[model samples]
Target: MIAGRMALGILVALEVAAGCRRGPAPAEPVKVIVTKNGWEPWKIPARKGEKLVLLVTRTTDETCATELVIPEAGVNVPLPLGKEVRIELTPERTGPLRFSCAMKMFQGVIEVR
Candidate 1:
């Protein structure tokens, strides 16, 4: 009985150790709202070398921010009215990256550290 209990304990310990070796957890996507003024929470915080996902949703039609343009990242996507657009990017450097409307009328920044 003692030998059997020792084997079971060793097996349980190994299982627990394997379970702790998981990879990095996925980063939570940031929800951005487009209003008449511009992107809500215009200042987004991001970590360097990590995947950044942006769930962009346009809630108003009064603004010229019908598209998102990230010149540095070479991302230009049209924003459909009342729909969510997913934009994923991995920031390689630490700094402020600008995103704006097609006409450059509205702008926001992603602050990476």
Candidate 2:
């Protein structure tokens, strides 16, 4: 009976060990709201060399804010009206990367520290 209990305990421990996460944990995507004022939570914080996923949702059809531009990262994405778009990036360095509208009238930043 003692040997069986020991084996059961070892199995449970093995299962627990297997469930533990290894290496870099997957980062949850950040949600950004786009309105007439541009991106909400514009200043995004991220770790260096970490992959970031920005999910942008446009809540208003005001102006020409249908498109997004991240000049430094060379990302120019068109955001559909009242729809969501995803932007994935891995920041290699630490600094502020700007994201703006096509007309550059509205802007925001991704702060990597």
Candidate 3:
């Protein structure tokens, strides 16, 4: 009975410590501008398992990057010219997540660590 009580006490302590611990802080919103050159800041950085928010705005109609596609994340969305689009995703693993246009012509990389 004494051993059982000690185990229970340890479990309670661990639970309390876990409850007091904090997760990674919420990331700041990243703004990506789509010009004729394609997605600006083509290389993005992210942390695995952390929520990432992107504020994407397209400023040109001449580019073929009329849409954003992230195949691995199952994301496909249109980017209307001169409008801001919010994209939220969490990197499940550490690697390069590729985002490209509908035609796969223009591309960008999200480096997750």
The 0-to-1 C-alpha lDDT of every candidate, in the order given, reads: 0.78, 0.73, 0.78
RMSD of each: 16.6, 16.2, 13.3
Superposition error at 51 for model 2 (Å): 0.4
lDDT of each residue in 15-101, candidate 3, tens digit only: 122234377765897899999999898999998878777789999999799888876776678899999988877777788889999
The reply for model 2, stretches above 4 Å from the true place, is 1-23
Ranking by lDDT: 3, 1, 2
Residue pairs in candidate 3 whose N, alpha carbon or C atoms collide under 3 angstroms: none
Per-residue lDDT, model 1, residue 1, is 49
Count clashes in each candidate, considering only residues at least 3 apart in sequence or on different chains.
0, 0, 0
> Model 2: per-residue lDDT, tens digit, 93-113?
677777889988888888878
- Superposed Cα RMSD, model 3: 13.3
lDDT of 1 by residue, 11-88 (tens): 111112223544676489899999987999899998876767788999999989999887677678889999998887
Compute each candidate's TM-score over C-alphas.
0.78, 0.76, 0.78
Model 1 alpha-carbon miss at residue 84, Å: 0.4
Better structure of 2 and 3 per TM-score: 3
Count of clashes in candidate 3: 0
